[model samples]
Target: MTSWLKAAAFGVGGIAVAGLATLVAFQERLVYVPVLPGLPRAYPVTPSRFEIDYEDVWLRSSDGVRLHAWFLKHSPPVAGPTILFFQENAGNIGHRLDFVRMMMQRLHCNVFMLSYRGYGASDGHPSQPGITIDAQAALDHLSERGDVDTSRIVVFGRSLGGAVGSVLAFNNPDKVSALILENTFTSILDMTGVMLPFLRFFIGGSASNGPKILNFLVRSPWSTVDVVGKIKQPILFLSGLQDELVPPLHMRLLYEKAAEKNTKCLFVGFPDGMHMDTWYSGGDRYWRTVQLFLEQNVPRMIDGKLSSKDEDEDDGRDCLQRL
Candidate 1:
């Protein structure tokens, strides 16, 4: 090759190497967004504001990382089904109080939601392995609680939380009664290409034949697709067709895989629902779908039928409005 061409080629190669190194070194920052812009780590609101009975909880992960959570109860003796919520990547569990309140009001089930290690009041940085440990700790805590019914534990996760919840359910099939995944991607390996289209060229083929180094650079490959097939529990997939972050196709892939193993696999797609606004856009239909799924799969749980009273009572008012 000519001298000028060779220099240009060398420069491009060096830049590519540097870019790959940067991604490998700091990829966690991009994956786990504990705090969004203008959103503080401190909770903006809590279940108490909505008059919902809740307890501030702290549990230690297997690695001894302190994790923060809120255990919300329907009435008193928390004997029926429980919904273990796993939040999206951008914020802490506190941001989901409204959803928790609605679930309790409509479903009459206990809710347990925890901030993974490194998010909110939880200790340590978030990584795939570390968050996995954190999820296990949360489940262990629930299992130990006398108020919780270990048999009817339903795991509900959104976005990145879906991947985390999937891992937890795959690991403990007997412990989890059902799983709900919303706007979740198939895997970090798949999401890398979706978020960064150029990477598709380098990581398209099968694992055995694909560029091994490019795959290695994916620090946190929370491969939900790899484990959903192994989860024998009932699973409900909520996909927002208009989800800008995670394409609706990802949810389809997960549903297909899970259906192969579990007959109770259900998929619901919202035509106008976006990544973060599916609950809002889906209106009563979204909640009804969830209620029906839970009722059908998880026997003896409190009725979650979305009634007009449930709609008029708290649905209209913001959770921040304390009565």
Candidate 2:
């Protein structure tokens, strides 16, 4: 072979090798692992200085899938909807035990939180589909409980949980009295790309999207515009100016897309609030916003009991608008 031809061949081979290496290493988001296809897991539930209080509960999904959940009850039941707390993507419900403790102290209702299939003691691996099924299983479990008021049940999810909650609330509109989304993006894809200005372009590539490739990191099942419109339930969205996981503007876009003009859609954007703890750091205003929402939307019936469901004020639409 000629010297120039040989050099050209070597160059092409080097490019091929580099590209293949990049493809293999980043194809599944490098370090991001799917929580599903995994087995039973557990994490420590750390409370605040008060030793975050909670009750251990186990429930099975429809497919006989077992899930671990934490039920945080408020003493002296007040007339309000029971909160089914769906958390963000992280270790487990145990990680947010401190937040649960604060919820119990502030809100005058019950709070139950469960881990996705792979996190905590919940059985089965986690996937977008798996989490949806498990959420339904959670709803089923709550429905069977004699103490739970079906009409006054509230579905609350933060970040990734918002996608899960939106799907559940959309399907069973009648079942969900209201919805509360905190630091939640419109969809997983939106969460990873659209909301992330710096890394938005990396959705199709890797090494750039380190831990967001395979772990339910595709098109998210939750479409806030669709879900919020279909369900007549009251909705409240909370977000922070500095929530890195699920950017603040995304929350604003979600608010604008909501169809109902007077959907009772409220936003509580804290000037200095952090991600999940916007409520924690915002102090009285944060808790009051939530309390006021629950008070207005999930007010008592003639018997004085539980019932029903943010952020900025940005006016815009999401890509889902095309859908």
Candidate 3:
């Protein structure tokens, strides 16, 4: 009976080791999900479908990896601020056209969104280092374009993309006018505990208790908290309190960190908003908050001097244009 019990325990231990090994081996697959089951590698639709004018942009990263993006100009182009959008993981920029259309129509800004390497028609597999290069490449491409209003580029990111935007803004403070993040976590190491509570024993007690085996194995740390304090640009945090994937506490933590380091940080929370539906659930308050933030922060060239748009004009539009 003792021998049988020993064998059973050994078997369980071996299985547990195998599971950990598998997680370490293919963690990138778990993090950067470019496509869902039955979702095509090819884009389902284009910006033209919504009667919006756009240009398909092809860029090569610093490491020579090819990337894809869409540049949607506001009417007359370069007249207003340009929003450099960073999308959440799990889908290509193709899936975000409706949201893009809504933003362009309401905000009256030029929009540029990139497909990080491995996603959409871009080349190479997705990783933290590679995606970071891709974001830089997108910015470089915009800088080269004479038609883009480079002076007023606002970096907007959601979830995983928020981490990406944070890193970019930290690295290039002069290039980015303002930063906006939505439903972003502090770090993937912190997120590991949130998603798989059982793994907490392996990760440790605090979020920054580093050098643990599980933390070492994380290929893409994407630690937004580490970089948020380093960014000098004005930051607007849109937090969905009801987010299921990434807890609302993550955004609050990020805001606190950013506020401590940078004076110009604002956080807006939506009580009923979920992980992906905050823009819709937030309603007119959401649009007004965003519009007001932009009006105050993002600047435009009036004649030869830099100036912000007037904030006294109220648009008074609801969130009927749900994406």
User: lDDT (CA) for every model shown?
Assistant: 0.83, 0.67, 0.84
TM-score, candidate number 1: 0.86
Q: Write model 1 residue lDDT over 146-254, tens digit each, in one string.
A: 8777878999999999999999998998899899999998887777777666476564323223464578778788888888889988888999999999878888988
Q: For this target, which candidate reaches the highest TM-score against the unseen true structure?
A: 3
Better of 2 and 3 by TM-score: 3
Model 2 lDDT per residue over 1-323, tens place: 99999999999778656654564455333212323235334465333335544567787777777878766656665555688888877657766777776777787777778887877777776666678888887787777777777777899888778878888987777788889888877655544454334345434222134544343445333455445555667788888888856668877877776645535677768888777678777787777677777766776675564333223522122211111
TM-score of each: 0.86, 0.74, 0.90
Q: Which residue segments of model 3 deviate by more than 4 Å?
A: 1-15, 76-78, 204-211, 306-323
lDDT per residue as tens, model 3, 114-138:
9999999999999999999899999
Q: Which regions of candidate 2 fall more than 4 Å away from where they truly are?
A: 1-41, 46-55, 194-226, 260-262, 304-323
Clashing pairs in 3: none
Residue 179 in model 3: lDDT:
97
